[model samples]
Target: MATPRQDSSPKGFRPAFYRMKDVIRITSLSRPTLYRRIAAGRFPAPVKLGGRASGWSAQALQAWIDNPSGYAAEPTADDPAS
Candidate 1:
């Protein structure tokens, strides 16, 4: 029998914030696509966690995934943005 793989997410790290690798996994987006969105200001900005570390908020990513169309649409005062 095969053993189940264990989840390795750090316990201290809130699920609301995820590492770049985790964001990639959640979005299933290629590196180029990710970079393109970032450049276009169409995606959430990553937070610098350390000298060489960055992460995106899981809440933001999940919100995007949950309502992709809404995510694509820029925030407007009429829409209240959230």
Candidate 2:
């Protein structure tokens, strides 16, 4: 049997994404709160991974975590849904 490999990559190696659960865990924010902030453009918007999947940029989230007060509000898009 093959064993599962752990995350042994070096830092700044590649793009890292945080799913909803990880995002919540890292930010300590509830799901609804996260979504609300996203809608309000007060938080980093998540990237669409596919038709039904989405993820947040780990770098962006880490930056926000490092300096919450200095974080800039995301620009609003022309689309009403955005």
Deviation (Å) of 63 in candidate 2:
2.1
Model 2 per-residue lDDT at 19: 91
- TM-score per prediction, in order, is 0.63, 0.68
Whole-model alpha-carbon lDDT for candidate 2: 0.80
lDDT of 1 by residue, 15-57 (tens): 7578878888878887788878866657766768889988887
Q: Please report, in order, the local distance difference test score of every candidate based on alpha carbons.
A: 0.73, 0.80
Worst 10 residues of 1 by lDDT: 73-82
- Tell me the deviation in Å of residue 78 in model 2: 4.0
Question: What does candidate 2's lDDT look like per residue over 1-82, in tens digits?
Answer: 9999888988867457889998898888999998887776667888889999999887878778888667765565765655
Native-referenced Cα lDDT, model 1: 0.73
Clashing pairs in 2: none
Query: Given candidate 2, what's the lDDT at residue 45?
Result: 83
Superposition TM-score, candidate 2 onto the true structure: 0.68
